[model samples]
Target: MERWKKRNWGWKFADHLSELYVVALLLGVAGASFAAALPLASRWYPPQYQGLAMGIAGAGNSGTVLTTLFANRIAQHYGDWHIVFGLALIPVLVTFILFSILAKDSLNQPAPQKFIHYMNVLKQRDAWLFCIFYSVTFGGFVGMSSYLTIFFNAQYGLDPVRAADFTTICVIAGSFFRPVGGWLADKFGGIRMLIMLYSVVAIMMALLSSLPSLTIATSLLFVAMMSLGMGNGSVFQLVPQRFQKEIGVVTGIVGAAGGLGGYFLPKILGNIKLATGSFTFGFLILSGIAILCMLLITIVQRQWRRTWIGASGKARAEHV
Candidate 1:
């Protein structure tokens, strides 16, 4: 359907509504693919190295940088930017074939979970904790990626191209640090790493809310993005541990919450801008939420240390 929409002959039938509907369908598939991949990584890797594995998988986000940087150039060069979409289909098809042929289920896979199992999983307090943590971390990263360019243009008076360049820098920093964050979580601990990451994010957001000078603000954003990226890695490091038996469903639910957080962030920024005539309030509110998440993490860290982390000492020793 998407391929047809991109073809010249089918362009006549591909109105705006049809294009949007196709996009919605594509996004659904993309979300499901991400949710599935999380559990696969957890299953394939040992407990201690799960964070590193998940971090590598999550780093696929770097594709955002490639598309943002090149999509426009491809469109301008081709005289029909939608041609890029058509070209993208080739890679998608190739990857699909490659994945189908090469991917294998883990030998130690758990029994397939039922829908009721997922409902019961959702009832667990830790599931909701992980969801909120991911919602803020992944949510903040994606939300900033979506809005940073606009913020630069509107707040700092940067031209569109320069704004995009700045955004790219922040995104690259964030994407590249994800695996490092995971490795650190493996060495240090996911919860401890996240507490620090959240504190840094909260501080950076607070500074950004003050609308500092361009250089300072850009630096803050870059640091915040990097921290948020790490926070994302750190959260996933703990997810598989907390929901070892139900990682798949918990991943899907937490991932969905993260997406919802991303969606709400832009709305919050836009609404706050309209209501109070600046983005300061929105940033402050987000900062507050980060702090709140930190407090929640602090509250739960004790039980987690006793139950999960303490029990996993043998696994960590094996990795060593």
Candidate 2:
């Protein structure tokens, strides 16, 4: 009996390790796609349309909504989470085939920068600024997407299915608004739009810290997500305009920062909940960060307008 138990434990441990390895590979591919796609989007579109184009491509993150909505249900139906992973490959394969057949490089590809030129992007202040901005916007969007279902279940006593439903609603809002945010940024200014959106995020997150009624909390999350999504679009709108020559490297850096931020936000929330018996401090800390981002953008915009983006923060047509 003891020998049988030891063998069972070994099998379970091996299964867990295999799962971790596969998840790591999946994330690696996803990260590379994100980093590579933005640069292509920027190059394919003109400066004036950069925000809209990138926003549309970035909106692909809405795929998370489908997973959040269905993964648990699918797993439960099959009585196996592994089956869910297997099913996910269908869309991935379809996307790969479609992209291979349809995708095209820009006609006027920029000359490849040297390794030193790519490294020099890290020395630029603007690159770091973009990283921080995306850390809050894209970071918050992804972090919340991962955590909201758990939040709903713990705080509101919702069933797993219902919690996932609520999370799906919020993810949909964020995903849908991304393109709208870019279009608005193009018409107004990325800086101006981000300032307003960050302010909204601060306010909504602050309200969430109070642990309001379920309806109100979900509404606020939906609104906050919209702002975060738009903020993502707004940030990228400015990226290509400022670092046209180094978009690939800059996007990779900024995208990594966003991923790190996403990773940490959930850790912060989970740790805060464990320590405080609530997520209030976590929400408050996020709110404070949003406010800080708002102020930083405000202070920086004066100089940004004076330099690259001009008075409106719009990319000048001549730059294209």
Candidate 3:
């Protein structure tokens, strides 16, 4: 590290035009690694435990809390934000070693199929539905996580630190509820839970478009995050149920849909702000989409019940 600093290598890396390409490559690798966990989680846990298991695993998203809570402080303390990136390598390395040692494949792992066969999931209507559903839930959670600080600063006149504080509060609310969502879905029904959640999210977003007071906005956002978080759990709970055999491939595809959704949300907000000088349109647009998602799910309800739901109105503990 000292040698690189002495050689001015850090500046070289930071200034090089091609660094964006390198960063993008590395990000893709990281994304693949993260998505791999979903399929493994399906194999390790039975159908009934899918929600709780995935929720607990997904709670790793709370890593956002750590970054939000400390990134600025670390930069201030060290006088170089880049140094925190170096420090982060320590935890990443440690986690990799622990995962390699502790993680085990399930005995009943899905049999290997031809590589091209995984692509066949594209033929299924349910696959697209799940992808869109996840795109809304996980995508909205991530999008909000990315934009809340900006939103707070713009709407409430908060400084960056205070904005981050508020953002962290929302992030934590969402993260904490992820497992709770899954557990509730396990006890209740994932689809039913999601219908209720999406309806609430639509209502909240519509109300938020009115540009309420700071206190009211914060409360509304907190509830909104909680609902989205739980929606995420519910979506995954149904995925494994519907695509037990193709869980791995479906997870990768759906996860990518979620990423695309997250990418678009901030852009939509930015566009609305630019065109209309207010973010009200963005919230209204999201509210309309939420309503559309509810209707889509409702349309599929009868088919899902006949095909997947058991006599208990819940997913069977075993895959059909």
> What TM-score would every model get versus the actual structure?
0.90, 0.93, 0.92
RMSD per model, one decimal: 3.4, 3.3, 3.0
lDDT of 3 by residue, 1-320 (tens): 88556544432344345764775567567877657787777788888888888888777777878877777677778887667677777878899999999888788787899988988999989999988998999899989988888999998899877888889888898888999888888878888888899999999999999999988998999999999999888888888888888888888899899888988899889889889999799999999999999999888888888888643236764653
Query: Any residue pairs clashing in model 1, and if so which?
Result: none
Q: Where does the lowest 10-residue lDDT sum fall in candidate 3?
A: 7-16
Q: Model 2: runs farther than 4 Å from truth? A: 1-14, 17-22
C-alpha lDDT score of every prediction, in listed order: 0.81, 0.89, 0.84
Candidate number with greatest TM-score: 2
Model 1 per-residue lDDT tens digits across residues 196-270: 999999999999999998899889999999999888888888888778888888889998888888778887898
RMSD, model 2, all Cα superposed? 3.3
> TM-score for model 1?
0.90
Clashing pairs in 3: none
The order of the candidates by lDDT, greatest first, is: 2, 3, 1
